[model samples]
Target: MYVVIFRARIRQLDEDYRRSAERLRELALGRYGCLAFHALSEGEEEIALSYWPDEAAIRAWNNDPEHRQAQQLGRERWYAWHRVEVAQIERAYGAAP
Candidate 1:
């Protein structure tokens, strides 16, 4: 498994931002082999996590044109700063007591 983490410092989140986010998440889940996705926003900070089965899936998702456009928007309007990290998920554990 692989995880792509995007940490961003948001400048402003407009209505358009929320709409864009929903559409992107829908596109990712509907078309790509996106195992899971989550977005967290707190004041000016935001982090989004996307999980995939492998690097190939991640690459395909990264190359998506709509996603590219969103990236540009984020840099130009939405985010003051950002960092992206791709990590190999070594293990996952869960339990129910």
Candidate 2:
């Protein structure tokens, strides 16, 4: 499995940002074969993690036009600084609640 982690120092967020964020997550889950997604924001920072079945799925989501547009908007307005990291999961274990 592949995992993408995004961390950012936020600038400001608005209605459009909220809408686009929701839409992008939906697209990832429904169309791009994203296995799971989680996002959290605290104070001025935000972190998002998404899991995929493989590298190809991750690449496709990254190259999606809507996601590209969101990236542009984030650079222009929503985020002060950001970093993205992609990694392969070698092992995972947890007990379901």
Candidate 3:
């Protein structure tokens, strides 16, 4: 399994930004092979995490045209700074409460 993490310092942190972010997340979470998605914001910081079955899905999601456009918009209009991290999940253990 693969996990992707995104950390951002938001510039224009407003309703419009939230709308676009949610739309982009929906697209990603709806894509084939996506296991799950999560996002949050606090103060000027925003974070998102997504899980995928393998590297190919992550690569394809990264190269998606709409995702590319969203990333460009993040740099140009929404985010003052951003960081991304990808890692393999060797094992995960949990259960529903």
Task: Report backbone clashes per prediction.
Answer: 0, 0, 0
Residue 41 Cα positional deviation in candidate 3, in Å, after optimal superposition: 0.9
The candidate scoring highest on TM-score is 2
In angstroms, the error of model 1 at 19 is 1.1
- Assess the local accuracy of residue 21 in candidate 1 as a C-alpha lDDT between 0 and 100: 92
* Residue pairs that clash (backbone atoms under 3 angstroms), model 2: none
Candidate 1 TM-score versus the reference: 0.94
Task: Score residue 34 of candidate 2 by CA lDDT.
Answer: 99
Off by over 4 Å in 2: none
lDDT of 3 by residue, 29-69 (tens): 78756789888889999998999999999999889887888
Candidate with better lDDT, 1 vs 2: 2
Instruction: List the lowest-lDDT window of 10 residues for candidate 1.
Output: 88-97
RMSD of 3: 1.6
Task: Judging by lDDT against the true structure, name the best candidate.
Answer: 2
Ten contiguous residues minimizing lDDT sum, candidate 3: 13-22
TM-score of each: 0.94, 0.97, 0.88
Pairs in steric clash, model 1: none
Compose the digit string of candidate 2's lDDT tens values, residues 30-94.
99999999999999999999999999999999999999999999999999999999999999999
lDDT per residue, candidate 1, 1-97, as tens digits? 9999999999988998899999989888888888889999998899999998989988888899989998999999999999999999997888932
